[model samples]
Target chain A: MTRRSRIVGAGLLLLLVAVLSACGAQPVAQNWPGLTVGGGRVYVISGLPQQVYILDAETGVQQATFVPSGGEAGLPYWSPVTLGGDLAFVGFAESQSGTAGLYAFDPETGQERWNVPANDLILPAPTYADGTVYFGGSDGQVYAVDVESQRIKEGWPFQAEEAVWASPLVAGGQVYVASMDHNVYALDADTGQELWRTEVGGAMAAKPVMAATGEVLYVGAFDGRLYALRADSGEQVEGFDFKADNWIWSEVLLANDLIFVTSLDGRLYALNPSDGSVVSPYPYDSAEVADASDGLRASPVLAGETIIVTSGSGRVIAVKDAQRQWYWPSGLPQSSVYTTPVVSNGWVYVLLMDGQVQVLDSEDGGLQWSFSPPESQ
Target chain B: MGITDIWTVLILRPMLNALLGLYTVLGGQFWLAIIFFTVVVRLIMTPLMLPQQRSAKKMQELQPQLKELQKKYAKDREKLAQEQMKLYKEAGASPMGGCLPMLVQFPIWIGLYQSIIQALGHQPLQLLNLSQNIYPFMESISAQIPLNRFFLGMDLSLTPQQLGGLTYALPILVAFTSWLQTKMTTVGGSGGEGQAASMNQSMTLMMPLMMGFFSLSFSTGLSFYFIISNIIGIITQGFISGWEGLMFWKGMSLSSLLSGGGAKGAAAQKTSSTSSQAAAAGSGKGSQSGSKKRKKKRRRKR
Candidate 1:
């Protein structure tokens, strides 16, 4: 090409880049719902027009599919499937208008059992306990719905000052919920009355994890601080607020005496259970360790001696005893893993953003089998 | 790294960090951050823009000579193109000069767009993605995770379609400002009455409409960026080409449209008609002289 033509070609290429970028057909990374295992079936939600796929846990073959009733196109399933008894609960949003709600379905028959509607979008998966399903809504309310009747509990919708993006935790007959309004509340499970609300200094999205004995609760907030609160009194544990370099979006993992917490800054802190002190010499940094732009969102899953963690930039790293063991797909443009991998029966199942599920050997991080959703097929 | 990764690192990441820095400095007010960022970007681009403006002015001045060359070389397309290039070089102007700055700024525009999406992550997954792009040194930005997205009662992270009502005004403003900028840039230059002029006129209308439609579906933050950028571009162009290029008030008053050259009380339609007639008269004189010179050369060869 002549010099002028070459210059024009480069200019056109740059213009094309700008036009493509501005055209806004950007493929948004999908946030796959967390998987649920029950009755020999693995329940998963995937795709933009969200559908519930029930697959054989061992075979990874599709057994049943459930599409929400409204027949709305482009509705996304933000909340993962929550399995309790025979029913699976999922939340979906109408993409055009932002109207959203939760639906209960029978996994075996692929039938809609009940749906509890809400005015705003629902992101947190519903928690089931004591014949009551508890969840938070974007409308700044914690709702308790009856499992059998599939209706909102009477006088049961407790309002918060801002949106509640965290899943409600029910322990010791008290429902603990976190809100974007920077407050965490402990409500009476049966009466829906507020017991105590404590300000956590930032918007809370991660589900607060409670200890097995129900004495201490660890909540990560957008303020980059992890607060260990007394589960009963809703008071912060003395000197237990661990500050990270960035927001904490993943739930704190409690394994043995060590608490594993991942920050958006890509560092995983192993804290002491008694007090919020760093247990490791330094947090396990992902490959993008120095770069704060990428980090772990999928909470760490402990399988035997190994901890399986997925980073926001899409690398699945296996660490044992604070030592990095292995990471898969050692190349550029890795698929983002948004849903936490489900480790069950010695097999690690990872759902990628592109609707592909890779089941790896839990011990060695070797790929066993992979399955893509029907939409990809 | 792959192209997308390289783009994110070199363009999107820095722009996002700069925007977040502005957001922090502006006390977390996202709208103010957008406005200030737009101003900064435009100011940085000002030097590059001068070459484009100069080339445009030179191209306008060369129009009459270009017409003579076209008439002389009507039979030989190659000769006409060569003569055009010769004239352009003599005038110290390059056709690409008008587009080079825009090409340079294209990456910035795309980067700005990506920055907007990455910074104002409204959804959970988007927020997760945002976490990966933030700079580690920007502790202040990291602390403001879930940055305040609301500006003037409208969520900047949401599409205008998602927020019906007065939020529609953002898209309208985007279209209006875009159209105004296009008009200012295209109206005075390329002064002619032909298919090219009609095409330019249509483009001035169509580009803004297309952008407006895009804004309807895009996040409001992007729409805000488009509107602010266009306004800045108009002001920048005004400074270069004189304020007469601006067409406001539905083009009713002719005096306002004319530059301050003592045509103070002239009617708008009459002044525009007279200017076109004068341009045509000048082109006619050039064509006549060129044809006579060609005839004289033919006689001398015989």
Candidate 2:
């Protein structure tokens, strides 16, 4: 070969290598906060240069963005946005400024109302009840901040043995939270006093759910067991323990007499609310329904009697009366869905991992509209 | 399927399954599984590398003739190119022989890296992604979901920055091992004291530094892979070329950087003695035989 040709060949080879390397090392998207729909808007938190994206509920058009006050331009938002009254609360976990904490924003104007600083990461979405906002922090503390003042309530930060990743459930003047330290605590909502504590065998990541009767709370743990406890006394309910094949990362869903729970093992079990016995003959197996080998992470949402489910492999399906009704994308897996399906105004909003929102008809599961984040546009 | 889909099916999925299989067989010890995987991959690629080693040795031996041709055809670029090819054919050497093996391994390296990240599942989402890739038949591997990431007091899922303290040792070890491997395998006599030598020198320094920076920011699981891969590379080079090409102090010796030639002179003497020993030890090997036979032919021609 001529010297010139060899030089050209070498150059092309380097370019090919560079292109292949770039293609191979493409960054995997980080887990973003789940989507929330309320007050005519859809709220989403996107990763890498994280910002809160607000879209029109009906049109799926960009409305506004609320950027939290932090030293760095890009930081991940791990906790989902919680809307209460006119303000939406969200938390930033790892920040360059060391000022990682929660911020309250006006959903309409996309303006920050106030910011409360925390020492460690906050991975759980804040729970808003009455006039206070409660959230769990990586600092192993459950904190209550006044909704109006945006300051943590006096004597309000209750310490736990490990990071508090599960969102706090506030009901009947009591706050119920599950901690990674393998314990569940019932605390006084007024004074941050611990009322009762019960130890579950494994670390907890899913938020505890309260029964309609307000007497029992169900929490799932990494040990593959779901614990049903008396809400007031923190005592495990008799004959209510359910063992799953794998970790239960999704929150337990209570609908009427049946309780729906999804496990990392890819099966969705509908159980009797009182006895924890499997209610459905054929549990909604994600592996069978959506071909999702990873199972499900986003909690199942109920649209009327139709159960709307999203999988880690990106399939969105609606099951009604214990039968698979309709699914989105029709054929191939397009993207992963990490957020729970939000049902509002007869439309189910599904947030994909790539920061796109697909809105489908709740009754027939037909595609209604789709919205991509501003950056993608 | 698309290129990415093909890659996932053909490369990434198989490697991921292998990693999970190793993790399961190693009694759920992820770090040990990574080290074992590195060794296995190196072993698989070892045979493909023999031709490259042989080509490198031949090129090095043909350096004197190549230089003479260059000098004779200094102004005639076309003549120089033609003569170089003729000389290469006569010697049965390919200029691209050393690069072909690397090109073949590049895809495997990429696949291995993706497998490590996906299998480690540093984030919950990654774990979910891993679930989708796993084969249903691999029940033992699937049962070990959420593999324990804590290895020797360090969370393999966390970056050095996140772990803090002596966790910084991972990046340092990565850099040191990479530098040692690069120094050992870098062919010396082929490009004696010119742009090629300087480029090799810069690469020996830059690659390790770049990899160290990556280790500092990436998850410790990846850093572990890099460190293990480098250590394996050093061993592989030692077996292939021996220590003749290995140099601890090349550009600026400790004494040259600091006081004077006392340390530099001592280091030079030690390096020379070691090189001679390694050369003598490695002389009877496959590639070494090729160079030796060429030298005999050249001596007969003279």
Per-model TM-score of chain B: 0.79, 0.77
lDDT of candidate 2 over B1-302, digit per residue (tens): 57978998899998889888888889899888888887888788778876666665566555545555666787997887789898788888777665666677667666766777788664555655675677656644543555776798888867798789999999999988877776555544323234443444455566677678767766787787888877877777777767654545555466432332212233334444444554455532113444466567778999
Model 1: which residue pairs collide?
A293-B132, A293-B133, A294-B132, B254-B268
Alpha-carbon deviation at B196 in model 1, angstroms? 3.5
TM-score, structure 1 vs. true? 0.86
Minimum summed lDDT over a 10-residue window in model 1 chain B is located at: B259-268
Model 1 alpha-carbon drift over 4 Å, by segment: A1-30, A96-99, A288-294, A313-315, A324-334, A366-369, B68-76, B193-195, B247-302
User: What DockQ does candidate 2 score?
Assistant: 0.24
**How well is each residue in A214-267 modelled by candidate 1, as lDDT tens digits?**
899999988788998999788898977588877888898898778999887778
Give the per-residue Cα lDDT of candidate 1 at B116.
77
TM-score of each: 0.86, 0.78
- Give chain A TM for each model in order: 0.90, 0.90
**All predictions: root-mean-square deviation over Cα?**
5.6, 5.8
Model 1 C-alpha lDDT per residue in residues B7-41, reported as the tens digit of each score: 88898888999999999999999889988988888
Query: Which number leads on TM-score?
Result: 1
